[model samples]
Target: MRKQLLGLAAVAALLTACGDTCDENKMVSGGFDNFPAPSASADGPTPGSAADFQKNVQDTVHFGFDRHDLTAEAKTALENQAEWLKKWGGVNLLIEGHCDERGTVEYNLALGEKRAHAAKHFLMSQGIDTSRLETVSYGKERPIDAGHTEEAHAKNRRDVSVVR
Candidate 1:
């Protein structure tokens, strides 16, 4: 009986020594220091958009590279677009900003914002109601033409106007 009691005590001691060291309270408390960042937008030009928008006027506009500032050509393009909008007042215009796949994400985001602002300003200047305008930036996510050519890059770095 004495030996059995001693053996039971030793077993209890071993069990206590080898017991789970992981604190349940530690798990109850949050432990991570950093979280993963979000993925970029996957949405691009609608499939068969040109064929669809052609039947009904989209008045969509495009822009040039690294340039958020509206050029003479851009202004002329907006003028034609504004005339069309004035005739068809119900359609809302969405200014989607795009950038070449070269710059950093943050830089491209700011550039995209500037491009959208430039187009929005043009529309506002042309007396298209600002209420009907929306701005979105795809950064370098969506390339109209995916080839790594200069022409492709040039075309990619643009603010396209979509009538949605």
Candidate 2:
């Protein structure tokens, strides 16, 4: 019993020592959408870091309900992303397609794929290399906003560009 208590105490101490560092690392490595954006300072994220990319260029674009087409706003955001990619020639991206919760799982998955492909094609049209872009569809499986309202559903319908 004494040995077990000592082990528990050590574990507690280690966890205490971990503190906020673990959370920070997780947020930097793509935590929930609510995680605050990294602050820009003199010693901000490195120029080619994911945080830098997110800060310098928009990383997400929203789609209309049940539609995979890019909106004018989405096209503008993708244009900015293309410019950023052009500047960082060596960086690659993972385009994640997501959808609202209204559709059947299979249907949502297919729609999400189309959404991701739309973004990829736009980037390619802007002169970004095809080899540097990959895409995946999460459908409604991973929603940034979990509420059932229209605003929430709108938020869920998106394509996110993650630097890889």
Candidate 3:
């Protein structure tokens, strides 16, 4: 009986030693810190309202490598954007198309234009007015991520909708 009690004590001590007090350098965040914050609309509501819009509405869409086609994800995001556009009828939107750092300047610019057009078309199809939507190609000139990694490249291939 004494041996049994001593074994239980040893087991309890081992469990206690392996408790929450163990130190670890585990990752605890989603890594959104590397991405830039959504830009606020100019001539629209104040920061409070803009923050609400950014938090509630979709403001960006990502694309595949060397492709301007809208994926289902892009369509979903654009659908949300359309709703926001409908709610704020008078606001103009600037769709800034971007590309990864692989293509030549001219090619990237053209590709970016296609990406912007693709997003614009989707928004228009969802009932957004053509007049309220404008597009500009930033190409690889304004990459959201500067690293040479694939993840960074993926992030760079995107269209950002800035309210005007």
In terms of TM-score, the best-performing candidate is 2
Candidate 2 deviant stretches above 4 angstroms? 1-43
lDDT of 2: 0.93
Candidate numbers sorted by TM-score from highest down: 2, 3, 1
Runs in model 3 lying further than 4 Å from the true structure: 1-49
Clashing residue pair totals per candidate (backbone < 3 A)? 0, 0, 0
lDDT per residue, candidate 3, 1-164, as tens digits?
Answer: 99999999999998899689755565355787744456544444344345555777788899999999999999999999898888878777899999999979999999999999999999999999899999999999999999999999999999998887
Minimal lDDT window, size 10, model 2: 33-42
Q: For each candidate in turn, give its C-alpha RMSD to the true structure in angstroms.
A: 14.5, 10.8, 12.7
Candidate 2 structure quality by residue, lDDT tens digits, 31-70: 5654434644456767877889988899999999989999
Clash pairs (backbone) in predicted model 1: none
Error of 1 at 22 (Å): 89
What TM-score against the true fold does each predicted structure earn? 0.62, 0.75, 0.70
